[model samples]
Target chain A: MNEIKIFSPATVANVACGFDVLGFCLDSVGDDMVIRKTDKKGIHITKINNFDLPYEAELNVAGVSALAMYDAIDVNFGFEIEIYKNIKPGSGIGSSAASAVGSVFGMNELLGKPFNKIQLTEFAIKGEALASKCEHADNLAPALFGGFTLVKSISPLQILEIPSPDDLYATIIHPQIEIKTSESRAILPKEVPLSDAIAQSANLGSLVHALHTSDYKLISNSLHDVIVEPYRSQLIPHFNEVKLAVLKAGALGTGISGSGPSIFSLSKGEETANKVKDAIEKVYSKTGIDFDIHVSKINVKGVKIIE
Target chain B: MNEIKIFSPATVANVACGFDVLGFCLDSVGDDMVIRKTDKKGIHITKINNFDLPYEAELNVAGVSALAMYDAIDVNFGFEIEIYKNIKPGSGIGSSAASAVGSVFGMNELLGKPFNKIQLTEFAIKGEALASKCEHADNLAPALFGGFTLVKSISPLQILEIPSPDDLYATIIHPQIEIKTSESRAILPKEVPLSDAIAQSANLGSLVHALHTSDYKLISNSLHDVIVEPYRSQLIPHFNEVKLAVLKAGALGTGISGSGPSIFSLSKGEETANKVKDAIEKVYSKTGIDFDIHVSKINVKGVKIIE
Candidate 1:
């Protein structure tokens, strides 16, 4: 195809105790993008709607990722990308990742799938680094591969796609506040107690098992974040109240989505997810913050063709 | 049902990056005990062989565990235990755990299996604390629940039984040197770098997934211990050389078994496991230190009745 229209899904990274290593894709929240081959032999960002994103190929996340993939291939043609941004930037639900994955995903499709998911994730990481100031595949991997993903290692770029339970749903509330990925990262301590580290690993390991077995109670018990959440949650207002409310409202677990400002909860079914959304809305609405709430089934497929 | 003879299998705890949380039961290395019910009141250690252990009900690991179970139950009779010690204490291979687990398991069987594995594990932990000076279930959970286990939480005593790959085998070598668990624990830093902790959790999460999916290569990649091994391996003689030798011999991974002196390697099959055993033997033979090696399949049954 000369041109492609794709729906790039948002993602939740740092998934409670799985900080920096695990993430999952979202179904209902994302960005729509159209990529077209051009006679001009270079990447270009032609238009971006609903957001004032940089049009320069070098400055844009989508462009940077597209260029990363483009430079590595022997393609004779260039591509122009138009982004219809729906997920807001700096909301911690992987807005940049959606754009970053969309560009390379569309380009790879237009180029007859020259690379695997790992390679596509590598390109996405370059673009992600521009936003987070560090390379992490947690968000990028899930966005590209779909479902839940564990980034086993970054140096070798190993990503394992974990099975997402069929009944799993995610409820997210972004409080319309900005929490820069870099600043959110900076607030974390350089060192953590060894006991806390062990506990975090135990929880993450248990969560992986729970996902495989589809045991919701184990998933609920394993969602604690003893390492990063305590520090980053301070950046978000009503974090404690929202968490307690959601848990009480039947969420299997709740935590900061990626960096902060966006809080996400996992539930066994879409009904519980919407109930969790209502709980979160109840708590955040009182603060008079212009927040956005989404109830989504765990997206099993990552980026998909819009047509 | 009034009397019971049991074989309590040994376990390897702190399996690489799963420090303080994970373990697996062994098929061949274990201890045997005969527990008999009597009309006379209170737990008793009637006879001991091959080892000098305290006979007092409260002082012995087995007796302490049996008493812990007995004190909580409204029993009309007491039990007598005869020890047939096989696994040497302080070999870093769950000798105390075998004894502790044997008592509770036998008692539970004789009492019509009233206690669940978690309750039995709790009783075993009380006895284990007598040897290690801290409560941990990494070893006891596997010994009670069988196969691979993750002790997700200690306070609430949560245990998760992980599936063992059918082809998995373990090769353990004990160098006959004493390194107390408390000493090994004391040598570790109270805090670790945030980056290392993240890497550790990633490896552990990957390991759990590997076990579920039966991906041997992923298990090999994820067996790295970035937190505790560096400090504890220093206590073991030629730790680095033995690790290299086993990895080169086609072992999936190798690490200090429980604490030090004894090292364990996991292989995909018994053939590779035997090869790993030869590699360990070759390395330890040059040091002129007396050592013992055992090759065992991953025991799906934790403790069994010796008919």
Candidate 2:
């Protein structure tokens, strides 16, 4: 019997020095997708909303992932998927991840949830690899377990769920700008100085420690992106201005969201988060760019299905 | 009355992926020095032991550090010094760090302990700076704090203590070979691929999480060092043979010790640690290289006064 279902959650990647090793799921914002079991053998996918997305199963990240899932389990079942694509296209907030994860979650449920989170993540990576042509587990982990996740190794993809800090608040602003992930990736240097890599690693260690200990100041001080941000900032409009404004408004730290055009800041409290949102709005308003701001705590719960 | 006292402890740097950001203190093995307060003014570091070390005060790492400490805190005090270098020179067990840390610690004691750990580390870096010409804090922090510590950052030199796993045994083998830190450092690549760096960071993060959760498998997997070790293995004679022996004897992981001719292996139990020690000795004996192996637990207590 074919069953249809949907799931969604927001995700963050390139998490400060973590680059491809770290990601977190945001329960507050995400996209939705429906997977229906079909007697048809081949998997079929349709983009209900975004015309920019491809409908072909091989070309579609979500459709390909559903197909991969069926192949892995050797189940004779097939799926027809409709992606709601609620997360705005090119938002830099892991819109693609939400769709892929949502698809995986839906397909797993339809198949009676035989595979585990690790299996689902592996299936999701096929989708991610298709989109990025690179193996990135950052988005996949959070989509599986929710909360904060550190992808320790990739050959076998060791994933560890990091405990979230209580006072962690994230304020994200989408500036209605577009920068393709591939383009942002192109600007990054192929090689980095050994000294810088060591420093970045140090900060990353401190950041992880701070998260476990709930030391907000340590987390704030450790939120530095030396390699990627330096090069990628040029592509985003008002990068420095937005960062400066957020910091001046009392954000603990600020940086590009994923590949950017979207910016996010970490704050200790709601007051500061609101202040950061207002400050960023002031800058973009002057530039006459449309933007949406979201202020929420670290999403401890990653993905869920609504009845 | 002027009394001079000095202390230094063995240190482990590159605490997992922390590369340069982490270190820890050893309790029993270290160096000690002392100085008599003299009525005369100005600095006069008159002596040094000639055990394969340069005797000149200005050129000697310990003497240069004492000079720096005196300049910063007690310009008016004069002292005649004696050093007992317990940690052998060229052991790849932070021998130079012991001298540097001992001088700063001794000078601080002579000057009524005006500086804290941070100040002491800063002073010790002056000595390390003379040797490496770079102010690296990994060795210095463990020499001062006496437990596992993450260097976190170097500019201001933030030191955070990481939770050491219980039942952790370390087997360190010194192959009686000299691999100068400077030469070993030079062998490393000036730049690494971004993918490599991220992989390293991921392992580092996983290692930390493993420590927190006490996941032995992940810790073993995460002990990999792609940046420094691959390049450095060439400098350490029989590196692969010794590593194979250690793992064959039940070590979780093994690697060259800090710019080394020495190697370290992590074992889960003391019984396995003994096996690792014997295994390492068998390999070194085959090469006809005189070697000393120490099977010790992670030293939680870093520095202490042995009256």
Candidate 3:
């Protein structure tokens, strides 16, 4: 694909109780890219001076995904792709998803946008699968459609756009600590108590209610993780301290974002969001962990090409 | 407590994923009674012809609860209590809860309403403690109040009133076949899969959403039981068949009500409710089990004195 402009946004997936079932996109923390036609039938990836990437298309996840999609549509076009990697890989903030989504989105546009958003999302999952080895829809849904999205089902493929409350604000804190997804996945227990299962279900119901009613209090209370967090939180340093500090500072709720050293807090207003961000930073500083805070409203748009 | 009247209503606890945490009352399917003053104070019990109860007060669950309440107050109010049990005992329909709640409520009123509902509920639990040796609040809350209630914590005692959608309808079917509470409790696995736990949580979230949005379709879709229903349904004859029949007949969802032998179908309107009732009856006939159907709206009003 030549002269193609593409954009992909960051996403948060495996949301606590949602595990493989929920995700949404973030507006500012993502990647932007452009592609141009080349004489060669194969592939070439050119990373911008400030960014880094693989040289061969096959070695690159996003490139492979784009190639696969273009092949399916009989688009025999040689292409040169360039990427601006705004999201860092292994950040637990859907870094790889942005790359994959951008590739498929960009290639589709170059080929006259032959597919709909859903179709592009399907192709995006193929790209993501190359890295994770599992097709998870949580990241793709949000990366494709922005806003708060619920992945109702994956087999038959269903995506529902949850009613996003206007007052919702997200505060994400990246602790600059590394906890590989593989290790995080290893720590989770295969079995859980029946009672715990019930509690989790109850919270899920409450979460949905909070979303529908815009009841921020309920939403905060409901953003708990009984299954994954208990195990994964241990891997994240100062996890409890971070959570306590955030809630104590008036954040409605705090939880590990995706899986990891990075954690997130949800607040109802700008004041609370600011307070929550300050609280998290204070705790991280005590532990001497380098971190950055991103405070923004939920991005309703998933992917957009600026060029 | 001589020359006094006590009233208690039937309750439905565990409201699906809320197991042990949620409960609510039903006005039509509860109890009404009078505990009159008597010169001889040895705790005489009488089962009014119109009401259902054990012949002896000491043997009657409600009577025992009344006696316990009196004992707690440090007064020998040796009294004669008559019960009008509107809820049939051992029907998996909160019959014992009605009696226990009735006794505590009645005695509280006789004692000048000394204890609040919370205290009264604690006293009522003594009655359940007498029967099962395990203190449970599922039945007590609904019998004490009138609508959807949640017993969030037991040790420290915390309760919350949950907002429910107005369009909710419950169609209860009681097959003559009996499934003892103790037996039903025994079959559940002590542990469950973590993934199942997560799925249950999602179902619960969906349920809360349905209630908040008054979306009958979502509520119906979300009424799935992954922990209790899977195990408990096996004990009920034609469980799968009955559920299918009810769903096919226009009910939004169907599951074993509380334990089993009693199945309740959630419907959106009266038309669907009647259809569910008839469908269950048709299934029961094939199983050769006589059954009674109670088609009712979601009970918002919990407990109140008829006198």
Candidate 4:
């Protein structure tokens, strides 16, 4: 009980029409972490492998998130952490979220799960803010609670765990490019046409309904982003071509994953997901951009113990 | 059967955060009509009662909708409709929708329902346009399919019938003032803050989830209209006072129903609905505006046959 090894999965936020509120977990892509109890009185990051991230407790997302949880509890001992990073920073697939959720999840497990999911999400958001420069739970909620999550409200931090369809799979392609969350957010207009807002709400509402009923066709029709995608897609090279190719390959829908550099397509089955992956790969390979593609089922369980 | 008599229920469109896309049917307020087969070649409005509406087929909402449906069919016989209107025009409670739905629903029944709900909605929208100057299926979908409905899209006409909780009830207060839908719509800003749009979408997404799970608290939390209400509420007299009184009376949520003047509050059960009605009535009594209030359960069977 004093030590734990866990795998924290990556997540896709915004989710087309569900901008700033919805996200889902990925199964095949994640980061592994090891946490052990130490008599030292606070959170300490002893090692970080494969990624050159800050080792300072205040600067590292994992360390900062673990510290948030640690400061709230009356534990006599501290925790030591070692992260084996797999999700690259600024890949637009919740890279910081994986690390933030991992540390808090591991710390809670070591402490016999004192805080609930919402509290854990709060702690994670503190660390997530260091990356995005704003507090958002879209990525953190899905990573901590698994499957699909909706940040219904931020002031109260209400997160609704939407049920992912049994056959749902995600195809994600990261082009090894960085789109800083702050810069991506800056490009959006301060105001949007009211007509577009209504359309976006309709799509998001239908998407929620589609998920509840497991209607793939409705999901396909509803995965439209009339509000954010039009502007943000400009930042990602060949975004339109890749989306068109994936849709033609039978993806239910495609959009920029989170902010950019990574694009995601949702398909009904694993086979179709792989087809979508191949389609996107073909499109991206021609662009001569270094890319990583993953086809994974919707991870129903968020962060989990590896050993 | 050559003849059919029906009751087409009134519906509350907008429903707070669901402006332009969501609505629910009401049990008590509606219009009654009798549609019969005729040997003649076209639709005829035989008699009008209680309300002074256009007798000419083309000018009437019921006739316009029925003609739309009749024209699409290859039937030899025409039809005659007798209207017994109870729902007042410009009530903002889908008064036109009730009449429009009644004719098509009765005709569909007479013709053995050759057209499905979507086709019926298509016909209904043609009629609704006469009243609102735009085609929207929010009210018509609920009035046709019963319970709650979301008009996911307009061009392809996607209607999703959301399930209503067994105990859900509605309290409506009509303040006998005219606010034309077109004019009410004109008062809204052409552009809205992007932040408000995101908040509106989040509320709508949560509302859909609340409907699926029968979570009353979530429904209460999600029934906020951030985009439309601020402007539209100004048109209704004593809106703020009535809303405060109803919420204090334990109503789940309250907002301008459809376009204005008439306000709607949703409650978990019939008892609370009646209490909400009483609360609104108390507030409106002092405002010197004549009003009518009705409390009813969610009409799950939208337009129904009485004989």
Instruction: Judge candidate 1 against the unseen true structure and give its global Cα lDDT, from 0 to 1.
Output: 0.93
Residues B1-307, model 3: lDDT tens digits: 3466645665666666556666656544666777665667555676565534566766677767777777777664466667776666667778777777776676566667788888887877877766556887777776676566656446656455566667667788778787877898999998898767766665665555556567777766667777788888898888899889988999888776656567777788778788888888888878777877788776776666556
Ranking by DockQ: 1, 4, 2, 3
Per-residue lDDT tens digits for candidate 1, residues B1-307, read 7899999998999999999999999998999999999999899899889779899989999999998999899978899999999999998889999999999999999999999889999999989999888898888999888899999988998899899999999999999888866789789999999999999999999999999999999999999999999999999999999999999999999998988678999999999999999998999999999999999999999988995
lDDT of 1 at B4: 93
lDDT of 2 by residue, A43-126 (tens): 788546764788888887887777788777765656888887767767877776776777888888877888888888888888
Supply the TM-score for candidate 3. Answer: 0.81
DockQ-better candidate, 2 vs 4: 4
Model 1: residue A171 alpha-carbon error in angstroms:
1.0
Report the C-alpha lDDT of model 1 over A1-307, residue by residue, as the tens digit: 8999999999999889899999999999999999999999999899899778899998999999999998898767899999999989998999899999999999989889989989999999999988777888888999999999999989999999999999999999999988766788789999999999999999999999999999999999999999999999999999999999999999999999998789999999989998999998899889988999999999999999986
Kindly report which residue stretches of model 4 are placed more than 4 angstroms away from their true locations once superposed: none
Candidate 4 per-residue lDDT, tens place, A182-300, comes to 77889999999999999999999999999999999999999999989999999999999999999999999999899987999999999999999989989999998899999999999
Of the two candidates 2 and 4, the one with more favorable TM-score, higher being better, is 4
Superposition error at B21 for model 1 (Å):
0.5
C-alpha DockQ for predicted model 1: 0.94
DockQ of each: 0.94, 0.68, 0.42, 0.92
**What TM-score is obtained for chain B in each of the predicted models?**
0.99, 0.90, 0.89, 0.98
Model 4 steric clash pairs: none
Alpha-carbon runs more than 4 Å astray in model 3 = A1-8, A14-18, A24-28, A33-51, A55-82, A102-121, A145-147, A160-166, A286-288, A300-307, B1-28, B33-82, B102-132, B139-167, B304-307
Error of 3 at A112 (Å): 9.4
